[model samples]
Target: MDLEKPQADRQRDPEVREPEGCLVVAIRLPVRIIALVVVLPVRMLWDALVVVGRIVRDTVLRPFGRALAWLGKALFVWPLVALWRWVLVPVGRALGWLVKWLVVVPAVWLYRHVLTPAGHATAWVARGIRAALTWIYERLLTPVGHGFRWLTRYLVVVPVVWVYRWVLAPAGRAVAWTVYWTGRVLFVLPVLAVWRWILVPTGRVLAVVGREVWTALGHAWRVTGHLSLAVGRFLGTLFRWVFVEPVRWVYRTVLTPVGHAVRDAVLRPVTEAGRAVGRATRRALTSVRESVRQARYDVRRMLFGEPRERVAMARREPAGGETRTLEKRVRREVSPPTRG
Candidate 1:
């Protein structure tokens, strides 16, 4: 009965076999699809983000790392550096001496000996300055001083004045007159001849031109007189029509009660309306100024606080839930109610 029961159970269970390899593969297919579609891409992106973040962090921290390395090297590796420096000191000195011999020493000698006092342009400039100063003193100062001294001696001193009046003064005047006469005789004859020859013809032409100009001017004066008379008559008629009649009409008509009515109704209301608009605009500007002051105070408070992150969060997060709650709290804290 046990054997029969086992056989019956096996028959009932249909041999009790496991699934085939194809079934296992089919079952894993969706999982593989999910991995390829969702998991693999997410993992790859996560890894890429991690790598990018690492690169960014390294880029940002590289300078600090280099600074720390340099400091460490400076602090701990100084003895090796000192040894190298000591070993190179003689070489450095030799190099420096070579450079001095090659470039600096010759340059200094050339400057000192050839480019200083006896340089070509320098010596020439110095000589020119000295000559100019000497010439100025001799030509300008000495002559001025001698003339003033001679004037003082002749004008103020009694013996010098007597010698000048009797001897030097007359001789100077006679010599000056002779030289002046000689210059006059040399220059005046030719000048007078040229003046008479050229100027006589020029004067004749000028006289003819003057007479023509006078005749034209007389005709122009007659035309101008006639034009002025016509202009005066026209202006008289225009003045009678424009100024006098308009004044008379205004005095007669516009000073009446209807004019007063028009003035009171139209002009006065327009003036009052203009004044009211001006006052309203001024009040609006005053309110805007007060609002700006409050805004500036709020801006100052926000700036002194952590504004960048808050502003970024506010821009990113919509005004709902936690954001609205926070905004309400911030508004309440930043702007209290008026105590009216």
Candidate 2:
């Protein structure tokens, strides 16, 4: 019953085999033969080379690289680190301390003890001198200046004021009146008459003429705009009918059908033929390359003799208990959250 169950399963399997017909066998036999005769040996050699490379890397190259890295660090990095840590750092700190003591400390002391006190003393002296000058100006010079100003006002300013008030003022008024009447008769009246009569009427006439000219210019500009718009519309309509419509009709009605015919008849067949030739050329090239490789292999075999066959490495995938199947999806579903 167990055996029958397996047979039933095999019968139900989609991958169960069918016997090949002669044409299929004919085609497949050459490919399988080529795979076994050519590809199998090459695949085995490649696997062997991969294993040998891994072995060499693990046994020799990796350790050698690590050693080289360590040697490089010891030669280049460690020396620089030692120089910076032991020599350069100590020297730099010493130089910094020496500069602080020799230059910075002395400068600070000079500014604080000597320069600061000297500046304060000079400021005090300036303040004293300023106070003394202020006292002299207020007590002695101010009263003397006031008395002098009083004497000058009575002696010089009082007489000058009297002369201007009593004598000079009336004479100046009389002279000003005479000058005013003389200028009024000589220059001002005629100028005023000319401005009121001549300039006003002439300006009014020019203003009226300018207003009419501006109105005419505006009307002419509007008429010109309308005519330009009408001519542009006519020319656009003419161009569409004469050039654009015919060209559009030719492109859509004539060129479209011709293009379709050329593509269907000439271009398509030419492209298909080119693809077929390319496929054939690739197949021929593959056959030639295989033949050349086989010939070279045969020459090497004749020269060096046959090497011992290597055992294939074991696969890591499960072969027991139907661990995985092609029909099953690999994705897993996550659990939902608990209410707590």
Candidate 3:
């Protein structure tokens, strides 16, 4: 099948066919004859009228239009543009500069020269007043305050402290020492004597009794401990022989064999079956997962209509030769022409 022919046939719709070549020529020749024979003079007359209208428009009306345009520009547009550029802009700039010099410069000068110096003078005057206050305090008030303090200390505080240290303290110490010694002699000495005579003897007897009782208790405790130990050992041995050994023997001889039998008959097979089922389930699930993954890849491939792997493979191929050719072309295009 011819591909271009089929495409051309599709482009030409069946409802609208082109006329034959001879039929087109026949139709066009008559139209041309009629136009030449009947319409030629009228067309010539229309052309003449158009030429006259164009000549009049170019010579007279166009000049008048040009004059009107020039007058409008001179009267309205030029004046406005010139006023804004030359008068308004320059006047605004000049006013800004004048204000800077007249108002700002003088204000800055007054602040720097007059106000600043006045502030400094005022500060100096305040410092002088403070110094005067300090001098008065040091010369007059400080001396008077020191004298009053010295008089108060010597007259009132010093005598009070001295009396407390020497006269009152010694008197109080003597009284306390006298009372303490008197009480010790009157009460404490007799109490000490009574305790030495009565309580010392009773305590010595109690000490001897406690020592004897403690020794006897220690001997009895040792005998009881040995007897208890022997009895406990005998009871433990009897219990082991009577109960524990028999139970151990039963477990070793009977229960162990039964457990082995049950394991071999039931548990092992069940365990193996469960493991086989689990392995089969895992394999089935893995196959299902792989199928799902392949299906998803196929769906994506169908929807997007291109394989990314092929594009990536194409990109990975080296393009060194193409790059060199492109570079040579670019150099030929960009470099300046050499002298012949």
Candidate 4:
């Protein structure tokens, strides 16, 4: 009885819920009616606005835009294009051809015929004048100049030179010889004679006396030289023992150490400083060189842009079958048609 009651309640549950569902429906029916009544007129108005906009665009705007375009093309663009292509281009070409044929041709022909011949004629006249001048120089002026030269040379120069060589030279030589001989005879011979006779004997006696005195002096000098040599040897030995050896010893012991100390203290440091300065200068110069190289590279990049290697790739040719097909097409295109 309980199982039957539960099954019966499940079957009757939907029947019992129908009135609540109908009440909810009854509640939503007026709202749906009010929404439909409001939205239908709004939709109709939107559709009417859309239809009007489409009609305005299709009927007025599209045709007007197309008409404006056509009018612009006809009025401005087409006329200018036609003027350039048909009128201006053809006129310019015709003017160019006319200038070439009329102006340039006539100018060239006139130059070739008249101006060149006139220039040649003028050159021929100039050459004739030059020939006339050359003939005058050769026949008249040159011979006259030569005659004058020969006359001057033979008449004036030869006579003067001959007179100087023969007459003047001989007279001058004779006068010189006479003066020389006169001086020799008057003064030199007597002096020579006096020297030979009196002065020579006197000088000979004086020379003998002087020779004896010289011999004595020479012997005395030899003795003095030997005594002075011995004294000099003693003085030299005394000087060496007293001064030179001590000075040498002092130099070896005291001056040498002092000099070495001074050198180490002053000169070595100075030398090392000089070497360091030189190394620093070399490094600076190397850095400057690198900077300059970089600047040069930058300048080159700025001027010519980066270096690019261009490789030329060979074009791939058509295969044999393709080539044959293309050739057949070309042959068919090029060949004349036959009558069927």
Candidate 5:
């Protein structure tokens, strides 16, 4: 019984003691209703603007942009490309050749023939000077540098180490300890207390409020979307019934039969007559063409003597000579016998 009482009290404490939950519930319904009312018209307007923008882009802006791009390419881009390819490319190639001959070749020759020997001579002198300096440093300056290092270690480094280890280190440690306590008491503890005790609770309350507001907005947006869908469907149905059905009925009932009648009665006879006239006109044109061709040929024959017929050269007599007819007689010839 005692455990059950504790569990009941725990559940009731969450509901009764936390006024935030009750306040959120009290405000949620009205906030969402107001949000939906405000958001619906804005959402519809946004959708309408989006649709209009798409239509304008497709119909006006896209074609105008394409035409502008084409014009730019035609007027500027193609001419520049042609100039680069045909005129400027050849000129550049010629200039490159001239530079190679006049400047680059001479420079390379000067570097290889003149500068290389001069550099070698300079390098030899530099090496001689460097050898002398190296000798002086190794023989004379090395001992002097070591002597200075020894004096500095005893007079300066040793004293500094002794002072740091004996005097300054202890004093620095005392000062650091004092500073740590003072900062902790004056600044760190108070800031930490404020952060943990005051700011954390305030931030938690504000966070709860913000979360509730955001959730209400989301709910309202979803509800507005559903309402908008329902309204759009109703309007579409109304438009279909009021406008589309009557137009479809009139087309099917009245216009279709009337069109068919007009086609059969009036259109067919006129089409056949036109076709007959066309054929007759074509025949007359053909006769007139033949007459014109004949007249042209006669004029050509009168202007220039009749065209010479092409005669064929043959190796033997005509083929008709081989075929004998009753009107023609065959001839026979004798030849001498060959000597042995």
Candidate 6:
């Protein structure tokens, strides 16, 4: 509004002026048309040409490289490979044939010529040996074997016969005498004693008494037995009823039940306690086993590491190199040892 003129010309211009004394100036312009007409298509074409060039190069070079490689293989590699195959295959075959000739062929030949003949000879010799063996078996070994068998039989059978004659014969006579004596003592002598002392007198007395009693009770005498038989039966029945039956009944009733009850009450608890102790012992043993396993593992880790180092050190050291500490001593005895 004052003295400054209006910058209408500068405002109408497109480019802006640089500052005073500045060497360079920047401007903004619409280059969209230029980029659209020239730069974009040219860049696209350049990229396409680069790609096409790479494709064409690869396509042209691939077959040439293959052909060149094939030619090189045909010229150099194939001949050398063929030559190597020709040399090595025949050499290997020749080596195999030589080995066969040296080892297998000779072995086969020896088997055919020497070993076959030897085997035939050996067969004949084996026949002769069998004959000789049969002769030996018949002449020497059979006799020895028979003699040994006879000796064994004689040793056993003769001793058994001797025992039968010497021991069993006397023992049988003694046993017969003992049996006769025992029978006499148990039955004949006792029967004789009863007849002499008790039975005759008792029969006579019973007869007299039975006569008197029959006179008194004549009807009862017909119901009773003979005097001796009646007296003996009465005594036997009294002994059996009074002594044997009472003892047997007491044993069966009282002793057996008491023994069974005592066994069930006392021994059964003891047996169960023993089984519990056994089970506890087994558990303790298993725990000890586990502890032992852990201890062994720890001991192994402590003592057995660095085995190679120990072996190396041992190899460096001399064996049995220590000096002896004790003087020698000797004792002499004259008698033969006694054994139990």
Best by lDDT: 5
Which lDDT values do the candidates have, in the order given? 0.73, 0.79, 0.78, 0.79, 0.85, 0.71
Q: Distance from true position, residue 12, model 3, in Å? A: 99
For 1-340, candidate 6 gives per-residue lDDT tens digits of 0112248966877875543221111111112222233444444455557767889879987888999999999999999999889998899999999999899999998899899999999899999999999998899998889889999888898899989998999999999999999999899988898899998987876665444443333322322324434555677799999999999999999998998998999989999999999999999999999999989888987898734444444453336865433331122144456798
Query: Can you write out model 4's per-residue Cα lDDT over 80-180, one digit (the tens) per residue?
Result: 99999999999999999999998999999999999999999999999999999999999999989998999999989999999999899999999999999
Better candidate by TM-score, 3 or 5: 5
Off by over 4 Å in 1: 1-158, 220-340
Residue 124's lDDT within candidate 5 is 100
What's the C-alpha lDDT at position 194 in model 3? 89
| Runs off by more than 4 Å, candidate 4 | 1-225, 310-340
Mind giving the per-residue lDDT tens digits that candidate 1 earns over 1-340? 0112265676788667444345333444343333344444344455557767899779877877899999989987886688668867878999999999999999999989888856888789999999999999999999999999999887789787788889998899999999999988999887998889998878866665564455444444444445555655787799999999998888778777678898999999999999999999999999999999989989998879645554444465555565556777688899968998
Residue pairs with clashing backbones, model 6: none
* Positional deviation of residue 306's Cα in model 2 after best superposition, in angstroms: 5.5
> What's the TM for model 3?
0.28
Query: Which of candidates 4 and 6 reaches a greater TM-score?
Result: 4
Pairs in steric clash, model 2? none
What is the total number of backbone clashes in candidate 4? 0
| Best prediction by TM-score | 5
Please write out the lDDT profile of model 3 over residues 1-340, one tens digit for every residue: 1111255675776754443355443444444444344444454455557768999999999999999999999999999999999999999999999999999999999999999999999999999999999999999999999999999999999999999999999999999999999999999999999899999988876665564455444444444445555655787799999999999999999999999999999999999999999999999999999999999999998999767564444564447675446777798899999999
Clashing pairs in 4: none
